[model samples]
Target: MNETIGAAAAGPSDIAAAAGRLTRAAASGVPCAPVRDLIGRDDLAAAYAVQAALTATRLAAGARITGRKIGLTSEAVQRQLGVDQPDFGVLFEDMAYADGAVIPAGRVLQPRAEAEIAFVLGSDLADGPLDARQVRDAVEYGVAALEICGSRIAGWDISFGDTVADNASAGAYVLGTERRTLEEFEPVDVVMSMSIGGQEVSTGTGAACLGDPIEAVVWLARTARDLGEPLRAGQVVLSGALGPMRPVTAGDTVTATLSGLGTVTAGFTEGAAS
Candidate 1:
């Protein structure tokens, strides 16, 4: 897999070294330098290879895959990165937090929060054209979600490959309780308002997510399937951000409300020394 990544530009040793750097950063609660020098910027396959290595280690340690999260869904961001499509990260069971739960500050490095629509899949999306209809039909319900993003790369300075290798800067997530079927609510029609410490900080409509959040899922379904891991039943899909991501600090309370999907909140605690 490493040899195939980036057409062998980043070999097995390179992938291992990159993964080791990120693992240490996460373990020490200290951000590390970018891995682009090792993996090469724009080498997406090499970056994903690094991410896969880390994920494999985690799974070996008993962590389980829960779902996936889409990133770079913003058209502006895509243009800035010279890419037309978004990237994705694997979600682990340990990365999920209950709505209203207080997250430990030390659990993530340089955390940020963004509002998103969480789609809980009711069926497999392993085959077919994976069009908008197939993606929507596979959804069991939609709920408001808070994605707590963090970067292991120091100062959040990253190139495309850097962020991808860092698992799309994924940290954790909170899912709302209210579940509305596709018929009950249209994803592109919902508006989002997110506040921290009772102050509005981010706001956007579902259209901000690749024109529609469902479209993001369609892209993800195809991408994941092509990569050999297809979207399956009961896995939650975070359909990219509905708005800008805001930096989060210890003790900050994040609350996001999505029209039709309801609200979700996450609290940050004063961290313990890591």
Candidate 2:
């Protein structure tokens, strides 16, 4: 929208590597002012073309497609973003960490914690009216997850394009034990609690995510359809964050509980051992 961004809108290459560089920057917790400067460019459409190209780069690198994440999926977040709804981003195998794992802090530019519900897909989902039952039926199980969001754009007010190009600030995440399926339990009505180093931090209900976490899953299904990248079987879709997001630091321990769903834990380390 700005004059500078107006010029970037015409740059084809801008879209090609924006997301990838932003991803790399976020993972390493480094400044990416170069990318941030192009936000709101009139050249954004072509830039997104370039940004979308990175999807092929990841696929070519043997990074398996896992699922997608719906971010800002709440009225509160929408207000924060000055938008009506939320946005979504792609997820790959490289962004995942098993439960009880110690995350290498060196990889993330700036790490933050968010509580989420993950839905493992049962079949392919494409554009169409979303059904709560279909989402419930497709759900294999639920896990308590910690979404490690990061950013590399120094100090900037990210526009929709900026956030999207940064892979929604997705750094890494941890998945906990499974807790049946949506059909077997109330995934959206649960009361959740989170702790850091054995200290209570946030509390909320699954309703915090667009009223129902399943609805969040449904939202992802429809969004992917719009993007021509619908959900596929075996893909795990992570719902939006519940409660407030917490920042991560070296040597910190985090544990999140989803009432009936169980718990997930992650530890942060300065770097890989020598």
Score candidate 2 by TM-score against the native. 0.86
Best by TM-score: 1
Evaluate residue 76 in candidate 2 and report its C-alpha lDDT on the 0 to 100 scale. Answer: 77
TM-score of each: 0.96, 0.86
Task: Identify the runs in model 1 with alpha carbons over 4 angstroms from their true place.
Answer: 1-8, 272-274
Model 1 poorest 10 in a row by lDDT:
1-10
| Residue lDDT tens for model 1, 1-274 | 0122235478889999999999999988889999999998878888999999999999999999999999999998888877677889999998999999999887878999999999999999999999999998999999999999999999998888898999999999999999999999999999999999999999999999999999999988988887889999999999999999999989899999999988999999987433
Per-structure clash totals for the candidates: 0, 17
Candidate achieving the largest lDDT: 1
Alpha-carbon RMSD, each predicted model:
2.7, 4.3
Cα error of candidate 2 at position 178, Å: 3.0
lDDT of 2 by residue, 70-164 (tens): 78776876776566656666788878999999998865656788888887777777634657777777777887888887666665456656666
Off by over 4 Å in 2: 1-11, 17-29, 34-36, 39-51, 155-157, 272-274
Cα TM-score of candidate 1: 0.96
